[model samples]
Target: MSNYDITLPLTREVAAQLRAGDSVRLTGTLYSARDAAHKRLNELLDAGLPLPIPIENATIYYAGPTPAPEGYAVGAIGPTTSGRMDAYAPRLIALGLCGMIGKGERDALVVRAIRKHGAVYFGAIGGAGALLAEHVEDADIVAFPELGAEALRRLTVRDFPAVVVIDSTGMSLYESGRAEYLKSLK
Candidate 1:
């Protein structure tokens, strides 16, 4: 696996060079959203309405962070299961979404969409919410405030770490790792 120091707004050229299992420290802007927001996004798409937030060539984190404590920009913000967004990912990818951050393996459809769209999927370390929150320098609700913690948030992050779970080539660290483990058991 390679290590990359990426400053976001991840472009297609940069995203295509990433490989599954590569580690990255991403610094810059990203939007935070979860299942509730994704569902709403799809609904807007179906009705031919423009998205509330600009998704083109953008990265999104699947999370619902808790309220900030004291001086923190954000609280314990951890990734939710990536599979939960599977139902909505293809549509977003088709709209030029480039990167996604969350935990767990994605469904087949989402994987295929990422490859076709030249996108990347990063796997944030799970169960490290508080530690992850330290990387977020700022967070502001961009849309859907009624969803509470699940509202779409624009975040400024520094040294935010993640692993490339699915690269633009459609390579998957989850599948490869599982295969290697099985081979080792033989």
Candidate 2:
């Protein structure tokens, strides 16, 4: 029930605080990067080029936001499917990315990798654009602007609401919830 502001170079204590099904209101600087950006990041890693920003203890939000309307910093920012980045996530985790914020369930391989490296996956509300946008106070593209919505944006968020879908221990709220429901049905 306690709230936390996760900053870069996250400590083990902070990572441990995040757990599946726990509601969290994250604040501070978060990086936005989706499937396309992930692909490019991997390419950069393979080429041994410096990353635009260090991923050490950083939390990456998997979203391809729509263009913000006039006067808004961002618009319709919602969590995209997390499975698309499964193959590339282990690389990012190895690079020191501590956690990820996105929607839906990730695969077993991704879950194993997340635990293997010490990272958490948060699930923000899916299809709640206006609600989610309210949390994003400011947004600016830091790199790969050419990718448009898929570009990486540096966002300052306030009380950004999210639920932990996968904790550092590899626990999954979605799967447990489904099992509970199915047990009730039986």
Top lDDT prediction, candidate number: 1
List model 2 lDDT by residue over 32-52, tens digit each: 999889999989989999888
What is the lDDT of every predicted structure here? Answer: 0.94, 0.85
Error of 1 at 100 (Å): 0.5
Model 1, span 78-102: residue lDDT tens: 8999899999999899998999999
List of clashing residue pairs for candidate 1? none
What TM-score does candidate 1 get on C-alpha atoms?
A: 0.96
Candidate 1 residue runs with Cα over 4 Å from true position: 181-186
Candidate 1 worst ten-residue window by lDDT:
48-57
Estimate the lDDT of model 2. 0.85
